[model samples]
Target: MSASKMKILISGAGIAGPCLAYWLARTHLNAAVTVMERSPTPRVTGQSIDIRGPAIEIMKRMNLEEAVRSRNTTEEGTIILNASGKPFAHFEGGDKGGDTFTAEYEILRADLVGLFLDATESLSNVKYLYGDSIKSLDQTEKTVKVTFAGGSSDTFDLVVAADGGISKTRDMILDEHITKNCYNFLGQYIAFFSIPSRPTDPKMWQWYNRPNGLCVMLRPHRNPATVGAYLCITTPARGQQDPAVEAALDEGVEAQKRILHEYLGNLGWETKRVLEGMDSAEDFYMSRAAQVKLPKWTNGRALVLGDAAHATFGVGTTLAIESAYILAGELSKIQSSEDIPRALERFEEVYRPLYTKSEGLPPFFPQFTFPQTSWVLWIRDSLLWFISKTKLYKLLPADEGSGLELPSYGWVDIHRKDE
Candidate 1:
């Protein structure tokens, strides 16, 4: 059981990759870890996400709680409004105000990534290669040979793809023919951006639901004069005609604003002001709701972790962080690559049932609803508002707490080993 020697290549540097690198290095001193990121640097802007229950425990294990808390969104709550700017309902903000925003740690996406990058940067055993990605993978009996876009290649004892759910590594290994529909398509498209916080705006979110597949929520930040806007398109599946696209599937800023205005325009409720800020912005994040599902997450010495294997919780950023923690713990339990497939199988076995449900309309929200132009947005907001207020919200498990019995970092829990 002397796991003193292990080498791993983890793909993606966002929440998961760096996390895995940290855990792997911590668990085995002799472990050499390298992470490859497609982006030039860590992402800076992302929606405010709540971390609860087990996930929080994992963060504490990584010793990142204080740093993570410092950058929290600290949302005070939000006011639901009509297209006319008339307020309808309100919801409480982050966990900073008791257990209202879920019984977990909540923070901005960028903040969490920044904390992780900072934690791993000084470790000589852990290396980060930004602006590059795996172009191909060639696996042999004892090693994984990977080719990178930067024309670099390396062989490792194991390869873990903590890359996001729409993982290119998954596509490379599983082959594109396997169209995975595990993602319960919430027919909505989301766009995240930063804009000015006007004096007229309160320290809360102002949600305007005009129907016709359009809903806008403005979340106020900790700083008085800054606010974040999340726009959701509930409508017909819109896309360009040329299907064979190679560019990043991201909707980008200009395009998202164009689509936003096309559907969410001129209804009032600070719409003009919000649109003005968004339109003037240089960048924005736009994405569809899709999850990744794999029949199995391992083939030989390679295993897919986090979103690359099973991405069910929609685009909520905290889920990605949680996935990283769980994967690291599971890997820590395994003795060698010989047990990798079993470890992956066990990991999926433990998590899938807790998340999978066959009730209440697939639990996936579609982007469009015909009567949405009416009061459906009001209803949805009202329900969320109610959940945010009452005990029902508590019933939605706060899985982000920092109390999970994880193995010691840089060392394995030999007692928990699989026989």
Candidate 2:
């Protein structure tokens, strides 16, 4: 394998795959990157996600800021409503720059996926395979043979698993002793989708949480006539993966919908209307808050990145984009083909500070996010209200990144002026 002609196979084109492709095809790296997308075409289904923290810096490094901003929902912030539907606590706005619950620069997941595709699709070295997936991975000391679902097999010098939590490669190389099974079961599940928008809907993200660990949120989207609906609550261990994790991985989508209806129907604040429109929703997704742990991200010539190797509570996009940039940056500096393994090790070293076993929320988060009792809910709400009013969170150390001040590796910045 020659350094100039390194063959890199990246599975999953959602966010991480395409991002890795972009960096690999950059003038600095120029590695041949092939992206395998399981979806028949580009993914157009997903709720809104924020490009926050260092991920935003990566976006600017890629010069995708304005292009991403153009698709913003322009959400002012979030309004936490009481059972009576009155405002309880409010966060200014969840955007990339804002330190709200989400991000200040929130956009539809589909839009961000499209932006990545638009950036890398035209690159000469980047190729996208739609409706294809890896069936088997056979890695030797030299090359890794990948068998796709379409009955095609290819060998690549280096393989990257960006396919996400259910990744086949992640399972194959996973040291069971290090990372747990695909389902980490975070004691919470969330179902989110888009529904019809109303003329009188608030411009900001509106949320309602019941003391019994039930939550409903309605958020305005780019389409004036559409709203993003979200449901998340604590539940028993069984049937946790049905709704959001993998589209009821073990059951039917209808079953997932039925479960939602059975449990949430009694709740107020347009729950009935949202459930009524559920079937028509295009991007309904449900998932448990599970984290995939791997002692070492690399195994021989293959490695995992993003959610497949490091599934967290949230920040999927941020982690994926940032890791992609860093991975390519590290690989680009490789002195020769053999230096690749050292680069992969360096990549994990950079991410070790960011990786953690306990993913999501924070200390005593369950008592607040999914309060089991009323008194706890009231106390949690009061604390959040006080924090919101006093702006005291700013007094705490900023969570911009891990405590580690990372070394700056020069990154390629792509710029196109359409404005």
Query: Which regions of candidate 1 are displaced past 4 Å?
Result: 1-5, 95-104, 175-179, 182-184, 223-225, 236-252, 313-316, 334-342, 349-371, 375-419
lDDT for position 381 in model 2: 81
User: What does candidate 2's lDDT look like per residue over 363-410, in tens digits?
Assistant: 644436777677877887888789877766545443343333445765
Each model's TM-score, in the order given? 0.82, 0.89
Model 1 lDDT tens row, 116-158: 8877777767788889999999987767899999998888877
lDDT of 2: 0.75
Which stretch of 10 consecutive residues in model 2 shows the poorest summed lDDT?
236-245
Candidate 1 contains a number of clashing pairs equal to 30
Candidate 2, residue 73: Cα displacement in angstroms equals: 1.7
Global lDDT scores for all candidate models:
0.64, 0.75
